[model samples]
Structure formats: structure tokens, C-alpha cells
Target: MLGVAGVVVAGAAAIGHLGGSDSASPTVAPASAAPVDENGVPILSLPEPDPVEEPQDTAGKCRADRGDQKSGAGVIAAFNFAYYNQRNGEAARALATPTSTVQPGPELQRFIDAVPLGTNHCQKITALSDGVYLVDLSVMRPGQPVDRGTQTVTTAHLDGRWYVDAFT
Candidate 1:
């Protein structure tokens, strides 16, 4: 009876030693997200986007080679250049009758705003009188062909300089 009790105790001790110790160490933990609030909700928030502003001519103003001339074609070219480039101030000064009472106002803004970003080249210039001219312009816009027909613009010589008066 004593020998059997001794054998049982040795078997239990061998089993406990086999299961207790381990050769493998624990793996390192991976990085995790930010901590949560007391209510178990995440605290992270996304940033807002910036607003878009209107286009501006940071590189001074748009200029043309023959914009200051006193001829009908020159006046038309200068006006068109200024209009397309959104240089309203230059257009008002360089393309209008020097002595006329008309000022650059909402009407000019409406007219220029209607034209998309592009150039208008003068195709023909006919002198209707000593002080008036009929200018035919070929309007061109980006991603579009040259306009199919000519737009006639009437310019007048006043205050000893050429000025755009009307268009048809």
C-alpha cells in the first residue's frame, strides 16, 4: 500500500511540471487608435475644407500691343483684350471716349460677364463715316471652333479718340 501511494504522488508531480513552464514569450502589441471618452465613444474629428475665391489677375493686368491706338481696329482689339481678361478698369479708360459721360457700370459688367474666357479677333473694319466704323469680329472660345458668323460692332470717333458705342 505505501509503494502504490508513492507512485501516484510522483506521477502527479511530473504532470504539473510539464504544464507549468513555457519556452515561448508573449508577442508585442500593435499600435492602437486614440482613447475613447467616458461614454465609450471615439474623440477624433475631421478638419473642414477651405472655401474657393473668385479668380483674380495677380500678375498685374492684361495688355495688348496696339490697344492705345486711335484707330477703330485698335480700339476694338484693346476692348476685347481687356474684356476677356477681366481688366475692367483698363477697358474703361483705354476703349472709351475720353470726354463721354458714360462710366464703367453694371452694364459693362453684364456684357463682359456674358462672354466666356476667350479672345475676339477683328476680322474686318469698314469706315461707315468719317467718325464711325463698322467692325466685324470673329469670337473664339476655348474648346469651340471660330464662331460661324461675324459680330458687327459699331465704334465712333469722339473726343479725338476711337470708342466702342454699340454692337449688333
Candidate 2:
């Protein structure tokens, strides 16, 4: 009886091995043959990446001459020209007062790094007070729209020179 049972088990195993088309087996399609939706669009398809813009070389683009430091607007113009157009932190800092927010440190370096490559132009300057003014500035970059903004610049007349006391 045991020999008969062993023969039956062996015969069942042989039958399963011969039948290779098992319904329980999982199927994987190649990448090129990805599954499609009802609309015939590939389900695994990804959108094309956006084109990356290269950084513009802004060195030597700014004028070597500084703005007239005698007026509050002039000092502000000089500061903006140095910081944004020239990317010169030291030149910008030179126009700032001793206790001004524009100081030499990581913060200054961060400002230099964050300056966009463009031409910084002083559009208009309106005197708010004796040594304070509202400056309308615009930045122009190649193949881009002009960016316009306003900032308040406070100047101090110390040691017979106008220096940027605060900028906001």
C-alpha cells in the first residue's frame, strides 16, 4: 500500500512539471512594452524635464566709476551698483556707515552670492527727509523682463562724506 501511495505522488509531480503554463505564475513586461491606459497612453511615461538656464558671467560688466557720494541718492546708487552689478561686497561695504547693516561677514557673503546677474539702475530718487530718500531701482537682465522695486536709503554725513546708514 505505501509503495502504491509513493507512485501516485511521483506521477502527480511529473504531471505538474510537464504542464509549464501555470495560471499562478506572475508575468513581467519589458520596459519598452510598458502597459497602456484606455487612451493608449503609456502608464509609466514621464514628462520631459525643463531646460536649465546657465549662469551669466557678470564680471567686468559694471562701470569702474562710483556714483557721487556727496548725496544720499548717489551713495545708494553706488552701493547698489557695487553689490548687484559688480558683485563687489567690499566696494558696497565701503559706502556703508560704520554701524550700517551692510557689514563684513557671512551675511555680506550671502548677499553677494544672492545678487542676480544684471544691470542695477537707479530709476528715480526722492528725498524723504534731510538725509533720507526713497530710491526706485530697476534690474535688467539679458532675455528677461526688467524688475523694478523701491527701497528706503538713509545716509549719514560723517567726516565730510556721505555714507549709507541704513537700507531697507
Candidate 3:
């Protein structure tokens, strides 16, 4: 598992340098404020910010929740779908950050290439930290026994989306 994580980090570094130094970062819209008239009257018809960043005493809100469990689950699901089910390396890579230092391009490609084509199912997902999750997975190939594994996946909230940063 640690070896695979290393490959992913290497792959990310590789992806980052693929286009040289000219790669442009994606733009994200800032959280918006409510509209008001010159006299401070509320314009109730306007759309409001989603308030995803509001502080909360409970476990659901804060900077920690910016890359929430739901997003982590989705990314892990998509990664599994692309890696095991569809065998689409490009799609799997898309779900990951391109600038990770631990997973460079060659290692990442090797990792992707080594993934066995099979059916993958998420058995359980546990949020271990704010932007990280522990995913229990079941993988089975035709005429083979089911294999179970657990991976700790880390994510980052960048450009308004959660990106897989590393996993082990």
C-alpha cells in the first residue's frame, strides 16, 4: 500500500511537469455576499452563497470540512471506478492532484499500469481526519477469490473541488 502511494506521488509530479512551466491553474469563484440597496435594504431575490465554510461547533463545518468526507468518498469511488472497472488511467489521474511531490509521473504510470482489471466495490468508508478517509475495498476478478484492502486516502480542497493528494 505504501509502495502504491509512492507511485501515485511520483505520478503527480510527472503530470505537473508534462506541460513544462506554462501550466495554468484553474480559476475558482470566491464565496459571494448578499446584495443590498444603497440604503442597506435587502435584495431578497438574489442568490445567496452556499455557506459551506461557516464555522460550526459540531463536526460538520469549518476549514477542516472544506474537503469533507462526502467529497473524499466520491473521489475514492471515482478512483476505484476508473482504476478497476473501466481501466482508464487518464480518468484516475484526473481525480488526483497534478503537483504532488511524492507521486511522480513515471511511478504513477507504473502504478496505474499495475492495477488489475476487475470489479471493485467500496465496503466501508471512515473519515479519519478532516480531509482524509480510510476506505475498505473489495476487489474480485473473474474466477478469482475476493480480495479486501484498506487504503488511507488524503484529499485537498483546491479550486472548489476535492483532489486526491495521496493515499497509503
lDDT at 62, model 1: 24
Q: Give the per-residue lDDT of model 2 (tens digit) for 109-168.
A: 577787566545544667889998877667675566878787888899888888899879
lDDT of 3: 0.62
Query: Candidate 1 at 116: error in angstroms?
Result: 2.7
All models: lDDT?
0.58, 0.71, 0.62
Candidate 3 lDDT, tens digit per residue, 57-160? 33221121112323765566666666666566666677788864335545556776776654444446577988787777676656678787877888877787
* Superposition TM-score, candidate 1 onto the true structure: 0.44
Tell me how far the alpha carbon of residue 161 in candidate 1 is from the true structure, in angstroms, after superposition: 2.2
- The superposed Cα distance between candidate 3 and the true structure at residue 75, in angstroms, equals 1.1
Summarize candidate 1's per-residue lDDT along 73-144 as a digit string, tens digits: 667667766665554754554576654444465566776667775554434555566545555556667777
Q: Model 1 misses residue 31 by how many Å?
A: 99
TM-score of each: 0.44, 0.55, 0.51
* Regions more than 4 Å wrong, model 2: 1-65
Highest-scoring model, lDDT: 2
Candidate 3 global Cα RMSD: 23.6
| Worst 10-residue lDDT window, candidate 3 | 60-69
